[model samples]
Target chain A: MDRIQQIYNDEKLLKKLQEDQNLTIEDVLENEMVINMGPQHPATHGVLRLVLRLDGETVVGIVPELGYLHRGYEKMAENMSHIEFIPHTDRLDYTGTMCNNVGYVLAVEKLAGIEAPKRAQYIRMIVSELSRIAAHMVAIGTFAMDVGAVTMVMWTFREREKVNSIFDRIAGARFTTSYTRIGGVASDIDDQAFAEIKQFLAELEPALVEMDKLLLSNRIFIQRLEGIGILPKEDAIALGVTGPNLRASGVEYDVRRAKPYLFYNEIDFKIPTFSQGDCLARYFQRGDEVRESIKILYQCLDKIPQGEVIANNPKKVLSHKTEIYSKMEELIHDFMIINFGINPPIGDTYLSVENPKGELGFYIVSNGSGQPWKLKIHSPSFCNLQAVSQLCKGAMVSDVVAIIGSLDPVMGEADK
Target chain B: MNTKELIVEKIKEKFGESVEEVSDFRDDLCITIKKDQIVNLGKYLKEDPDLQFIMCKDVTAIDWATRKKRFTTVYHIYSFKLNYALRLKSNIDDNPPTIETVSFVWQSANWYERETWDMYGIKFINHPDLRRMYMPEGFEYHPLRKDFPVLGIPGSLPLPFKAE
Candidate 1:
């Protein structure tokens, strides 16, 4: 007790505290308090640390400190071959691994000037939409859980598990399904896989409707969320926030619709936009997107053609394992490819797909080499997370959690 | 004329000599302009009515370890009005590469510029908050630079202080 009193009464310690905070101890205790919310917090979803400056319960300022999950993926991409990096991409936005895989392979394909066959394109579209639905489930569930609705998480995860099982049947892995290959998928979607997907899709609608009634229709949920943490349309665009968050702000600019990659031009689906730019609108925007994704998936199933899954680009696409084992020429080709890697022409190209979270793009600069000279990933979560400070300026401390939840930033992608 | 051709012509007309090289690779338009002209070009691209490149999609740097101008800063800007995206590249020849910040032009450039700086160590002049984006503040080496080894330098990333 004497030692504690001595330290508290020390002039040097008091002076240092005053200097560091630019305020006396009394002032800090009376008015402003700085609190570190994360690096590990349940509401933050991952290792995102938010240092919140609070005056009573109201947040004066919030600075989001990232990089706790920094894996240096771009540096790793430079070190490995194009095919060798596909699995690495699965770890980017773990919720939407399929979307990341497709985004990456599309970039590599665009650089090499090789197109996946029509069937493969439709398959890619199907898998990407499925991945979108699964990702949004986690987003909507975890977001509801963040805003004090825990039951929605169980319902959403149940649906997500069904999607995972479908993936397991198709890709042989549930979570980190590195199913996408360079010029095509690992294998064709067999009859059993199609049957499972169709069954899951049928089961999904009723489950989603029930979940909606339990959460979205509840009076408490509506009152808690409606106008909390509003980001205007102008700010949304200026900050480069994409995906459903940007759509909720009334931007209507979807990469699939605007850019039209892999025959998305032929597909008829609405880009759901909500004028309100609030937390509730962002949540509803994702719900609407799931409907659109279902529509796209149905269209894909109907319009999928019967042909070769992989493109016949001898230099670019990998050969079948059976052919590699049996044929001497195929063995030599596989050997050369494994050793030297597929050499893209001397050029660079940036191709982005409309991922579930936002636009996941890969900018590849190839110096006519087996591996990329430089690979830059433009992750949408990293951009969307930037708007949190602006949104949470004068809101209550709890609203900060809601705003971060609304952004749905996966730290793996954000810090990559 | 198409949007790409229109953009290229306008860019050429506005700042002809500053536009170092213009190339269309894989249907994407890339314009390599002088480093000093980045700010002016960014402003023109954003504010111009027809070429309202409102969103700065990404900012990254490419390190050519042996090149005279060792680093090239790249910006991918998108326009909703035009329904097209353009790539802007500029070479930095300084001892420690320095370039102007385009955050004032497009607000999205703020984080992207910070990330580029964190990864490549190219300084963005007049950036609002030019702190490290992904790496720890105490960490010295830029991981993305070609010269920086893949297996990082030992003892560079300091661990948390232990309570004695």
Candidate 2:
């Protein structure tokens, strides 16, 4: 009893207890301070305001206020024709515009019962995978930047720029490339564009390896990320989290694997998953996904059969501009499709594509009209963002930025 | 029988008359059930060993202002084990359109329900945080309704120049 009392009353032990007690008192005095972390902030990626209740350095609760970039995309879809809405979808996930375009067109095609040619599907797959690489580059770049590794952003953007240039050659526009049409893509990939894409893929491999050494292998980065913001597998599934965030949580549920629309079934690629479900897992998931996308790009380039890009349906699809000018019948067809729009049968359908961020779904309800009766976009970022509060609970205040970065949400998609 | 028919058969067997209509369009199984039975059906689907639909993919409401049943609340549920998707829809009347909250069954339904309520003015009973998701607070009108003007609520927009 005397020995126990002596140990308790020891000078060093008393000093440590006093220090811990002081921290508790400081926390009690401060109570819960509500701090707003941006509708405008660098780490947020976009206008995402997180009202965080903090007990000292620890996050007690978080209320994520979104819709700052809400452009009324669903409402706008109701008013616009099937073809007219393709461009608007580009803004849904601007970074992954090709995938967004593919997703929207696939939904419209499903509604109209039109099938894009095999070559078109292959071309679409190639472009979509390229877009995935570009999007992931940005995601990883920005994530590393948020964690104070600014040089990674410059390296990633260099590769992303190469992709954008290739996209410009094929699609006319770089970032907001409304490349996809209702029945097919806007244009076919030329030989020059294909060569450029091959070159970009070749260069991206070494850059990715360099990034792994710089960010992934670095001790400081690992220490900051490892086991931080761990989202349990059940919570991730329950909250509708998808893409790398969901994959990081150890769920191998990719839309490509589960419901293979397009030539995803034909393509050989692996869905990378990590059981850690932490910031590090999410980071590594994107890194692995980029590698898989590179594999898909290679397969697409190799296996792409030479054929017509668009479906030949005069009644439903528009003709080429040159053909429209040369022939009166083609002119009328183009005019009719543009002015009146393609009227799909009265029905409702939901179609989703595996976007870089996650499953980007478009639910279209047609009333046998040119325009959709109702259009609902199931944005992955928005669904994934729902799990943020759950992820942030009990995490340190500094870890909030890391968590947000790892989730890789684009506000345009979320708000849309 | 295929997965779609199997799902329909199981659902029909369990609920009997509660299952209103079942349709298979393009291999996509859509089941329309009575509105009151949604929560129970959701629980059963999630818990039942045969049909373990763990994920609620999406929840949305479509406003058919002209129809007797003005709103159709759609729930897309997916089973990881089975690798099948089922779309369950419930029709709600225009007069104070309300439905049971499935948020209790799937945590993802919480935000989806809030968004539905925000856009279509469909009240989700027992939702923990049922508030405007996209639109700001104190915004009264449900914009997605067919009755609402395509541009927006008439005269609600702050025009730079006044109409003559």
How would you class the docking of model 1?
high
Q: Model 1, which residues run further than 4 Å from truth?
A: A1-6, A9-30, B160-164
Please give, for residues A1-416, the per-residue lDDT of candidate 1 as tens digits. 98868868998987776678665767756788899999999999899999999998999999999999999889989988899999999999999888898899999999998889999888889889999999999999999999889999999999999889988987889989998888988889999888888888898889878988999678877877899989899999999999899999999899999999988999999999999999999999999999898888888998999998888766778889998889888788788778888999999999999998899889999998899999999999999999999999999998998899999999999998
Query: Which ten-residue region of model 1 chain A has the weakest summed lDDT?
Result: A21-30
- Give lDDT: candidate 1, residue B78: 95
True contacts kept of each: 0.90, 0.67
Q: Which stretches of candidate 2 lie over 4 Å from their true place?
A: A1-30, B154-164
The candidate maximizing TM-score is: 1
lDDT against the true structure, each candidate: 0.91, 0.91
Among all candidates shown, the one with the greatest lDDT: 1
